[model samples]
Target: MIDIVTVDTPHPYPPRISAFTRPFWEALAEGRLLTTRSVATRALTFPPKPISPADWTTEVEWVELSGSGVLYSHTTIHAAPTAFVGDLPYRVAIIDLDEGIRLATRHIGEIAPVIGAPVDLVAVRHTDAVSFAARSRA
Candidate 1:
């Protein structure tokens, strides 16, 4: 497990979001979020895309999620990659949002999280980039 720390600096690299991903980013910027839903399989797909990987269908729709969920899994890392080195000992977690979509994000807040712990998504601004944090249970 990596000992995770909150990153005070902005992301060093530019996030690459394509045309299909524009809506998702836009929603985040607007405080309204969107994720892709596969019509055929009735599944929520994160890392939004125009087509579904399972059925190859271009029927993906942008759906808003509650942004509240539980921490499905996580790890605290002491050392990070070059770009993320400044934020050593940071917690990386997979949050299972209320809508049933699992999103990987940096864990934040006061307490260490455990599996099945309730968490809420919060948008945080770093020097130049915006990121999501999983808040510990209230």
Candidate 2:
């Protein structure tokens, strides 16, 4: 199990959660990643949409992800926008979740990111809410 570290410095921007996205947020708070899947098309939608974003169908079900994936791409930003300047040298990446849904999230851990490297999801606790990051698997 990954430890969800609570940062003294809260995130400047937190997502606005709604009923449609509540399951996802609740699971993340428990260190589990949950999303919605389209029952008809097997398409996955992150952020737990009420309807299938791919087919606009109302037949959606909650699914838990394995939380293992590969880093498709990543880059470190030395210069961030004004709202994020305090957190300098932060890294972000596009991850190919094993379930076939791709998500963009922050990167954590000391390991240098490499393309195709295996990763696992980690929950980071902030003052306002919980967030996720991809940690490199050595």
Q: List, residue by residue over 1-138, the lDDT tens digit for candidate 1.
A: 111234577776646777777777666655555678788786777777788887889987777777788999999999777887777778989998888777898888788898998888876655665555687786
lDDT of 1 at 137: 80
Candidate that would win on lDDT: 2
Indicate the worst ten consecutive residues by lDDT in candidate 2: 1-10
Residue 18: error of model 2 in Å?
A: 0.9
RMSD of each: 5.0, 1.6
lDDT of 1: 0.74
Clashes (N, CA, C under 3 Å) per candidate: 11, 0
